[model samples]
Target: MRKYGIADTTFSRVDMGKIAYKIIRDEDDEAEIIRYTVPGIKDLPVAAKRLIDEGCDGVITLGWVGKTMLDKYSYLATSIGLIIVQILTSKHVIDVTIHEDEADSEEKLKEIAIDRTSKHARNLVKLVKEGKNALTKYAGKGLRQGFRDAGEID
Candidate 1:
């Protein structure tokens, strides 16, 4: 009976899960948006599938991973997120990504962390209310083309 889905894990930069919940429960006017946040990406695909099964119109992901892995596994993690979004999109699910900077040490990182977090969070709330946005608005279409998911999204 819900219109949207939320999924996420814990990270240092920003609380993507928390933000998603606030957007869905507080900002969103839709009476049937179902919000959920878990410990990590482990629950993402299952959650996405569940949304699809439940007839959710869209999905939002909020999660964080260290930017230290940028040269390492970050690509893989991003790829996985993209694949899930794509799969869900192919099935007609509206996807959105709200990228959050998890790099807490770098000065620019910190600034971006705070700035993007606020911007994304506030924008998310506004978008949810208007029911007119998706993650592809930031991360591009090929990699993300369905509901909204914030990978390291604060």
Candidate 2:
């Protein structure tokens, strides 16, 4: 059986890791799912890297960024760290983040987190089961996870 990793942050208002774990478990019963929770978004990179080193086929990292400028910079740095981890391990680390400003209300934020985490979790299954090219057909199709697809440009 294949193994997948989920790295999530406690700073997130929503329980994205639980949402993702449920989706992955429900979608693919045969695969093993390992979860690692950190205190904040900046710590996700190392957590994901550790999971990958522990033999996960791929990793899903979930984080929540505030609306502050400092949060933006921190998110950027965290993104770069995740990229470096992927490059070093040659593994797929899917970053799923939600900015607090994206939603107008707390309920909406939860909805976005659930939608994004669920979609990315399924994508992780597809990627591991089929291969990297599994999602290529949707490429340039303007597909989105948390919101409605933008659709293809005419």
Candidate 3:
């Protein structure tokens, strides 16, 4: 395996190397970094909590939000679901990655999914900063469900 290094930092391919490096230099000493990797859409809340319990400062979730070839059953819900789960976990998360792909065409089908996912991701981050679980109400429902709750900004 190829080993990559920066200054005195060295990383092995099989490790969460870059993240570990960042965590070490993170300004927030109270922060914990959590990464979630899954094969399918399942038990998102449980996954989020496990990372939080493990002292995760944030979460980077990897999974197939939708398949590019499939236009019908595949949708952005898988990505949106995990984000909502993070809302209920705690307010300690510093960042979250839903691992989605950009749309390939300008057709309505692709536009809808891409737009919804982008909007939800942005809103979820905002709600998280506000310390609220407003997005959880639409968990498992996908981006088409329009799950967003932005409370008063103070």
Candidate 4:
């Protein structure tokens, strides 16, 4: 696998950053992971695009948008931006998103973020070396409750 980039928002600073590195080390130890924390979710595309141009094979981004009307707009904009980045760069920008409404409390947000980010990070190596079916090996490993990825827990 080639060097990978982690482009996360500072909103989920603690959990996002921690789990990104953890999974890279524990699951894909040979990877060279570089992280860039942007101020908000909207900047994910910029960071990801820059990373791709700088020679990263792939990018994984993590962020949470609060349950608000404004946040909904921000989330949509961010999603559209990332989609464009992926299309233009021809690289996968794995977006690990957690909405405030998805969890009842901060603890749950952290739980979901760690679970999601780790899964995406683990997939980065395979995504570069093995293509899109990176984590398909673990498919059907767990139940898909809400928007959380399955196989995160049993």
What are the lDDT scores of the predictions, listed in order?
0.50, 0.94, 0.37, 0.80
Q: By TM-score, highest first, what's the ranking?
A: 2, 4, 1, 3
Cα distance off (Å), candidate 1, residue 138: 11
Off by over 4 Å in 1: 11-13, 25-27, 67-75, 88-154
TM-score of each: 0.52, 0.97, 0.34, 0.84
User: What TM-score would candidate 1 get against the native?
Assistant: 0.52
* Two-way TM-score contest, 2 vs 4, winner: 2
Per-residue lDDT over 84-153 for candidate 4, one digit per residue giving the tens place of the 0 to 100 score: 9999999989888888887787777777777777767767767787887866886767744234444555
Off by over 4 Å in 3: 1-36, 40-45, 55-57, 62-75, 90-154
Candidate with best TM-score? 2
List candidate 2 segments past 4 Å from native: none
Which residue window of length 10 is worst by lDDT in model 1?
A: 140-149
Clashes of 1: 16
What lDDT is reached at residue 115 by model 1?
Answer: 47
Candidate order by decreasing lDDT? 2, 4, 1, 3
Question: Best-fitting candidate, measured by lDDT?
Answer: 2
Q: Considering lDDT, which of the candidate structures 3 and 4 is the better prediction for this target?
A: 4
lDDT-better candidate, 1 vs 2: 2
Candidate 4 positional error at 80, Å: 0.6
